[model samples]
Target: SCCPGWSATARSQLTATSASQVQAILLPQPP
Candidate 1:
């Protein structure tokens, strides 16, 4: 495969960012 490591690294980073964003939205919001 061509550029296998780069693609996987990018996907991992994207997933991590998405998870963090979701967590932030789900957390309680202050008044």
Candidate 2:
């Protein structure tokens, strides 16, 4: 029973979180 707005919001959040995780993984660690 999910509406379009809720579905889009969930997808946006998911993508944002995934992109952030990938960026964190690829960034160099500071010594």
Candidate 3:
């Protein structure tokens, strides 16, 4: 249940354009 909900939320927020934006934001990190 928790995984389903979390995945749904993440998928919603990570739409195509937003996903790229998020990847860009994370790409410069030390990890």
Model 1 agreement with the true structure over 1-31: per-residue lDDT tens digits: 6887998999999999998899789985586
Error of 1 at 21 (Å): 0.0
As for lDDT, the candidate ahead, 1 or 3, is 1
lDDT of 3: 0.77
Per residue, candidate 2 scores C-alpha lDDT tens digits across 1-31 of: 4587998899999999998999789985687
In model 1, the Cα lDDT at residue 22 comes to: 91
TM-score of each: 0.73, 0.74, 0.39
- Top-lDDT structure, candidate number: 1
Residue pairs in collision within model 3: none
Better of 2 and 3 by TM-score: 2
Which candidate model has the greater TM-score, 1 or 3?
A: 1
Better of 1 and 2 by lDDT: 1
Q: Write the per-residue lDDT of candidate 3 for residues 1-31, one digit (tens) a residue.
A: 6586898787787786787888789885575
Off by over 4 Å in 1: 28-31
**Deviating ranges (above 4 Å) for candidate 3:** 1-14, 29-31
Ranking by TM-score: 2, 1, 3
Q: Give candidate 2's error at residue 3 in angstroms.
A: 2.5
What TM-score number comes out for model 2?
0.74
